[model samples]
Target: MNKMHDFEASLQVLRGSETDITSEVNVIKTAVASANKRTAIRFQELNQKKFRMPLILGIGLLVLQQLSGINAILFYAGSIFKTAGLTNSNLAACGVGAIALLATGVTTWLLDRAGRRILLIVTSSSL
Candidate 1:
């Protein structure tokens, strides 16, 4: 028997089972090899025509999101709110955070039901 079969048999013995596990080990090895082959095929197919547009779209959306200035607004929310004449700047900032949290929760709830593209269009347009 091979080293792997010997190792499995030893493991079975340690686990208090005297039954041969060579066949089980061979089956597991076969399954692993098949999975590896499938993974290799998928990796090779990542850059194919069918995946190209969606890949580009996802990257473009990320780039646009970064360019949207939302990050800057969020980072300086307290100062911005103060500049806008809000007496309680920190409270205003907290309100902004709460609204953002609520929007995120609503978006997550709507994602599957509304679908990604429609939600993306609506949100991006609103922004």
Candidate 2:
């Protein structure tokens, strides 16, 4: 009985004498609409900014990374094969690199819809 009275008092404070249930519902809906509008405006502003420049920068970086021989061992793997007792380590390394690249692309495709936070967590832990 005491708890029931406390609950009724809290409900009265939530409703007040002037505010009704419909007004409370409208307030919640307005808050959601405001949030959505703010998000849409943010997206519009981003679209109005330098979006194509990011693509050009990305392509330029990829070209530089590929042509610059950043990973010399990967680019000239024949020397590694000669140093070791292996005969075709270069071709084997190339095949392994191709398989790893394919697997990474597939994982990236899956991560698009599976949420980035989970992938970030898993990938960081893997590192």
The C-alpha TM-scores of every prediction are 0.71, 0.36
lDDT of 2 by residue, 20-57 (tens): 55555557557766876743445455454476676665
Top model number, TM-score: 1
lDDT string, candidate 1, 25-64, tens digits:
7787788778767434466686899988988898988888
TM-score of 1: 0.71
Q: Find the 10 residues in a row with the least total lDDT in model 1.
A: 35-44
Q: What is the C-alpha lDDT of each candidate?
A: 0.84, 0.67
Residue ranges of candidate 2 with Cα displaced over 4 Å: 1-77
What's the CA error at residue 60 for candidate 2, in Å? Answer: 20
lDDT of 1: 0.84
Q: Between which residue pairs do clashes occur in model 1? A: none
Instruction: Show the colliding residue pairs in model 2.
Output: none
Highest lDDT model number: 1
